[model samples]
Target: MRENTEVVVVGGGYAGVMAADRLTQRDDVTVTLINPRPAFVHRVRLHQMVAGTHTAVVGYQEVLAEGVRLVTDTVTRIDAGGRAVELASGGAVRYDYLVYAVGSGSADPQVPGAAEFAYPIAGLEEAQRLLPVLAAASASAPVTVVGAGPTGIETAAELAEQGRRVTLVCGGVLGPYLHRRGRRSVAGRLAALRVTVLEGAEAKVTAVTRDAVRLADGRELPSAVTIWTAGFGVPDLARRSGLSTDALGRLLTDETLTSVDDDRVVAAGDSAAPSGLPLRMSCQMAMPLGARAADTVLSRLAGERPEPLNQSFGAQCLSLGRGSGVFQFGNRSDVAVWFHVAGRLGAKMKETVCKGIVKHLADEAQKPGGYSLHRMKGGAGRREALEAVRAEAPAIERIS
Candidate 1:
């Protein structure tokens, strides 16, 4: 690469922002960040925004740190072999280190009319667009949310609590991660809110019109707003660039979050699929991935051995409605157990976590370079392993 210490970060979400902020600590490094939107969207608040309890559109102009360049353009192509990035506006960016965190996009199912009719709540823009649809419908109008994952559950709970008719169509179990108690609590909360949940029924949303949802079972459910919060699929950047990836299109990375076949490139956030474990697509993994990526990058620059990838989240906090949720405690793997929290207290914690996430970005932007060189507090044992990392060395391929 032309620039010895230049860094290019793709996307501006939690993972991208964290990477940018951490890179600023490297006094000798310059970071160039690219994303489609000018502002960073708080993805966690999307459900609240759709519930009509919050009207503000969250952003991150104030969250980015100084010395970090923010480019408001989409990345069209990544030439990994040449260490370059092509933007939609017709220009290319060259870099010595690249942190790919383009993140996952809304997964549209292959059902007949789902693509044409349903609105997903995965991004800020999507939630904003669904507001008008919810507002125009009456209180008793049926609002179906397809998918019973965290996003689906949260969206359904938030709206149902507002006295709107809400239905959650989950093809599988209510929550595959929840323990018996947590599952029961969630079910109770939904029932108390008068929400109808459909489980085990194949929800093939054949069509989405303004007034109804046609299913593959030859049933048409009356719906004013059909919100789909099903699954996540990463952007096609990694696979298109001829990189190693899983079947889900997620870039396959080694233990230390580096691209399996290219040490020059590191993957983070939902877009990164690490070997040995199933990583959940959430801010929980994204934050640590960013910090670890920064450490790996600085370790190479510092001429130290690099660390392998390792992360664990022993808990899951899900907001049931405004000021209410369930905090399912678990081990490193997300097998939620009996110990949990409920009601307003749990909701407050969720809110605090989201706010803290935003404030963290702002802090990183304000203090770049001054601390980017420092390694994270943990992982001291891996210092020697990081020493072998050369700036341009190829990665050891490991697929999930």
Candidate 2:
């Protein structure tokens, strides 16, 4: 009997789940998905979880394909030469093809006392931990949310809508990704909610204390609770496994999502850096990348040429509490355009997007090849740009 082509996918985020489910399209392949948690985490709803508005979890039974084997465990190391992965439980699983999709976490602030005093809600557990803390706090307690990105903005709005006194410390321009009009809309909504928005160099948080946050401008704000959504950081598994990775430890891959070090390995989602240029760490790109990664593996298995990735973005959706939102439209290249939708219409659009995300995943699980996305026509240009960079850097050529 001919043995099945074994594919082991690490991580259970949007990308990993999509990749694993899509790989089930091939009858000759067996897919195994390894993750620490049994439930799928809707990271976008973590702020809702923190605010007691919604639970941020769903079961894999609803999202994962029937053929994909689910393993509730953690991967400690990847042995490329031996084609095996060492599990924390003292065993190893060999694979013919490996998908590296371990996603991101809250970045360490590296500020004095920040780690000990501040709360991070990047993951499910972190959000769960913050829920009770918020519930126990006084109604008028001063709450500070660090960072002005989507996570920070959503967190502050959710809490403020619940009658908490919320302060948003932007540390820089508010909504750096938003266009002027979009930013104005967001600021207006925030102001209407009675939430204070602080920006510029002076708003940059330098340190966190037990009951206050000190800023670079030498101003201290009384923060009964400090929520840090400043930035995200991926796991160091790729770097530790001796794989070629970017400075942030994302596994480096070609446009086809194949790892630079070994053709048998592929990467997807936030953990993947393709041709040294990674997309923003968001689910907006994860599912498509995951499907693309699976296609690359299927092509290799069938001895066919794989196509390069052609990625594009259309909008950046932000939920400002339950009844309000901002859907800032963007060009194909992900640059924010002047057009946007705000108020209840934007909120409905945001709600549709959140539901559509899960629906896409579920649909992919049922019909892998049916899923499709907008493709950019800049593949050759990207390769040329990478070549130019390699010529100047020399060492980059080896990875390219």
Candidate 3:
């Protein structure tokens, strides 16, 4: 009989959970998931958590597969040569395969006093930290949300709906990824919610202080609470472990999500930079990446070459408030198109998606290998885009 294969997934986010659950297809494989938290964080609902709408946490028993062993610990470093990972608890877990799915968190704002004063809502703990701060502030206090990405927009709308005075600092264009029409819809919703929408270069935050945010135009806006959601940054685990990583610290991998340094190591979700080109860091993309990463390991175990990434995005959903949202449709390549669903319907769509994400994970746990969205027939645009970049420069020089 063949020896059992041990797989270790180093994250419990959408990607890591999906990968670990799907690996149960083979009885000869033992799966272990390591995460800092014991519960699965519903990151999509973190804004709602801050607004006292949802708890944003689910027990691992509800999502993780029965066959998988749960390890509640943080991975400090990966000893690739030893095929083991060092844990913060002063222990190690050896594995025949490792899936790097440590997802993203809010980037360092780098603005003065921003780190000291502003709250970040990218993770569970960050959102929880903001809850008490919000409760302590006066009801009439002005709240400033920095960055106009989905997170910033959702947070501002959520707070505004709760009767909190809110201002959204776009930094540049509001919803840079949204179509002009979609952007207009979002603007209308924010206007209805009484959120002060600040955009353009002049609206960029120059600095953040305890009681105010200074804009590039030298205007200081009173802000009792400041929330930063500008961008995301991955953990430095890859770089610290001597693994090849992109400029953003994402694990550098080949088309098959296999690490260039070791065949036994694969990557998924926001932390994966496959072919130096990565999909947008979102829950929509993470689940597919996780499934594909598991497929890569399964293919190798079967002595077959794994297929390259072929997933495609359909839409970007943003919850404006409890009753308002905008579902911006996108082509297979993920670029926002002209079509969108707005208002109540959009809110319903967003809610369905949020619940569907958890359901997908739970369903996959019940039936391993049943989730096949990652293998859909698409990604031609992704391939063409990669080829165009290759034509202009060498692959090594085209990291974006």
Candidate 4:
């Protein structure tokens, strides 16, 4: 290894920040975090920000490690051969190792007039833009939230709590990840809040206008404000840089989180596809992935073997406005079970989850590799995922 090993982490979200902070554990290593924004965005609270209930931002000082340097700029391209990254700020950063954590954003609406008329709540800028529009509009104007994912559900509930006429156009079953009972709890809350929940394929949105949204069933609803939280897509920097990526443009990595193309490159968060089975795009997965990514690099540097990913979800937290929620429990494999916590207790759990996310990051920032969580042991599911990946391509062996 060189006298001073330089590690560059691209992106300042949950994954990047955690990875960068943890990399600071080593005395001989230097960590530089490159991001477009100066502040850390608490993405889970973005819905509340749109509803004018939260700020959705935290200072890097509160979360970033003391030794880690922050660069407020975007990475335009990755020069894998040269082991350097080209930045939008008109310079290149050379690194011995790179952590690709540039996260996901709002996917293209792809519907007629939807792109032009519909407001999205995926990122900070989009939320900021929608805030002014919502403020200027009439209090009783009809508001439509497209997509029934966690983001859409929270946004619809928040607006309805604020006394807006909210309509949720679910493209399919509401909360596809939730159990039937949990789904019922959410539906009950929405009903209590007077927010209309339209489910099934017929409720899928077809297009949007300045004044309304058209459904797949040829029905149109008056929507003075249409908020699209349909789905997320990762930044294409990985694909554009000639790295091996999944169908969705996520960088392909082994179970250890090291890039298949180069051992010196790693991936985490929404932009990583490990063993052909990418984790769900949630904060619940990002922090663990980030820690694993750091471990891979540290192990390689120390000439030690790195452990494969042993990941599993425990529960899904859904906030209904600021007063109600559902803590839908899941098994080791992340499939929802019959049990759940509803109402204020659930809301408190959801709040704890949100606060815990930031606290976990800050803890890792201070103590580096001090974070730990109980993960499921490898089983048939992991074997099947690896078998599928090997069936298509050669297995990527760990370098060290």
Best by TM-score: 3
Ranking by lDDT: 3, 4, 2, 1
Q: Which 10-residue window of candidate 4 scores lowest in summed lDDT?
A: 373-382
lDDT of 4 by residue, 43-136 (tens): 9999999987899999999999999999999999999999999999898999999999998999998999989999988899999999999998
Model 1 error, position 88 (Å): 0.5
Clashing pairs in 2: none
lDDT of 4: 0.91
For residues 114-193, what per-residue lDDT tens digits would candidate 3 score against the true structure?
99999999999999899999999998999999999999999999999999999999999999899999999999999999
Q: After superposition, how far is residue 304 of candidate 3 from its true place, in Å?
A: 1.7
- lDDT per residue for candidate 1 within 166-258, as digits (tens), equals 988876789667888888888988999999887775664566776787766767789878888888877898888888888888888777778
- Over the stretch 1-400, how does candidate 2's per-residue lDDT look in tens digits? 5568999999999999999988998888999999999999999999889998889898898899999999999999999999999999889999999999999999989999899999999999898888788888999999999999999999999889989999999999999999999999999999999999999998999999999999999999999999999999999999999999999999998888888899989999999998888888999989889988988898888778877788767899999999999999987667799999999999999999999988988998888767777244533445556678778774332212
Question: What is the alpha-carbon lDDT of model 2 when measured against the actual structure?
Answer: 0.90
Worst 10 residues of 1 by lDDT: 372-381
